[model samples]
Target: MSLEVKNLVKKYGDKTVVNDLSFTMDKPGVYALLGTNGAGKTTSIRSILGMLAFESGEILWNGGKLDTSKINVGYLAEERGLYPKYTLMDQLLYFAKLKGVSKEEAKKRIKDWAEKLQVTEYIYPPAVKGKKAKVKKAEELSKGNQQKIQLMAALISDPELLVLDEPLSGLDPVNADLFKNIIKEEVAKGKYIIMSSHQMATIEEFCEDLTIIDKGNVVLQGNLNEIKKSYGRVNLCVKVEGDIENLIKEADLTVVNKTPNEYQLKVNKEEDAKVLLEKILQTNLPLIKFELREPTLHEIFVEKVGNVHEE
Candidate 1:
């Protein structure tokens, strides 16, 4: 199934938050919606999911109007949406019921997800020998555990389309990896996912296609690999034991970052990198590492947004 957003526009009073934002998911995989804070990424997502109204635009699913009520869609919103005082099991079941899942099936899915997310202790408290078993409330869990519960709620119904906003935002490294693995599994199951996150590295890992918005306007949108190729491999990284400050000056390389461990430089062309390498070799410095590569997603995002601000 394909999901398409055409000329989506949303305004609040006199300000337009999302203007002519458009993108398409023609097949199953991850699609990234990216922007800086208040850049309209979340607005575009809410509009697509039919949770918020837009001024003028059409969100279509399989050539027809997109409606959440008719389709199996799951969403993990950026803002946590749990009843803080309610039991985790109760909330999961409620979310599942809203998605039309059977009570019996919902319990089974909850059990499985709890194990996968390592939240079984909260969802299914161990017997207290002589005391009553008690399930933990949403507020009792850590932020990361609460996030897992929210994700379980999103996946309980096995939705065909999933939308995750900052899915790994507050998790520790271990929990973040767990979430990433689950996302990979979902992709392997051929689920279509729309993800929005500030973590460019995570986007690079999962999303092949993406749209980068800036101040409600589309700044870059296309296949990630193609975008990187267009920029060329101008990023050069070098590591050595001795100082290469004067050598870098002679080669006219712009240092993007310099640390005790390495020198991150920017070169205009491949020839410039070769010249730098030659100079380093001539100095008989102990070269630990030298590599030339394309600009990463993080670099591209910064450049795009920075240019938009300048304009």
Candidate 2:
């Protein structure tokens, strides 16, 4: 299913959370929605899910108007909601039932997901310990495990679109990879996903398309690589002491940004870096590192929203 949000506006008294925001997402790939906290990412997701009312705008699924009755979507919020005392299986099955899956079907899917996540061992009580045969509580598991369950729950219904907010928050390296791999599998099965995350590394690695909002407005939106290229600069990482600072001070390039040990410099459109390289070598400084590449999603985020405070 394709989603189109046209001139969406959401206000809270004198404050605006979403300000005439608009974007389109089609099926078959992952799209990342990136922004700092309180930038209206959550508010937009709730509007899509029909959980809140907006002052003005149109939300359409496919070519028609978007309505809950016309499509089913799965959402994983940043703050995941789960009953702490409910066993994983029981809780998942209950949710499955709400989605119209039969009890037997829900049980089977739960088993399959448990096996995929390698959490089958925790599904049942320990017979040797004579632990009462009851479902383990959600809080009983680690935060990573809870995140995994939340992801599984979002995918269990096999909805057309999966909305995941900070889906990788609590995962360690291994499990984060596992979760991403699962998302890839789902994409292969033709599921479209909209993921909101603060982890730029993950977004750059996984998302092909993205939209960035700042101060309740979109500052950048498009294909991930395309947007990065648009930031367009021959990025050089340098680690020399003397004269390096002076080179930055009197260079024909725009210093995109800098750190104590390194800096990002943006030259004019397609400006040749050969001149910059020659100048660096002549600086009587031993260069520890230097490379030319485009800015990343993270860099773009900081550049676009560095000083934009919430109104």
Q: Evaluated with lDDT, which candidate comes out highest?
A: 1
* Deviation of model 1 at 110, angstroms: 0.8
Task: Tell me the tens digit of each residue's lDDT in model 1 across 114-198.
Answer: 9999999999998798798887999998888889999999999999999999999988999999999999999999999999999
> Model 1 TM-score?
0.98
Q: When superposed on Cα atoms, how far off is each prediction in RMSD? A: 1.0, 2.6
lDDT of residue 137 for candidate 2? 85
Clashing pairs in 1: none
Q: What is the TM-score of each candidate against the true structure?
A: 0.98, 0.89
Q: List the residue pairs that clash in candidate 2.
A: none
After superposition, candidate 1 runs with Cα above 4 Å error: none
Superposition error at 62 for model 1 (Å): 0.9
- Name the 10 consecutive residues with the lowest summed lDDT in model 1: 126-135
Cα misplacement distance, residue 164 of candidate 2 (Å):
0.2
**Candidate maximizing TM-score:** 1
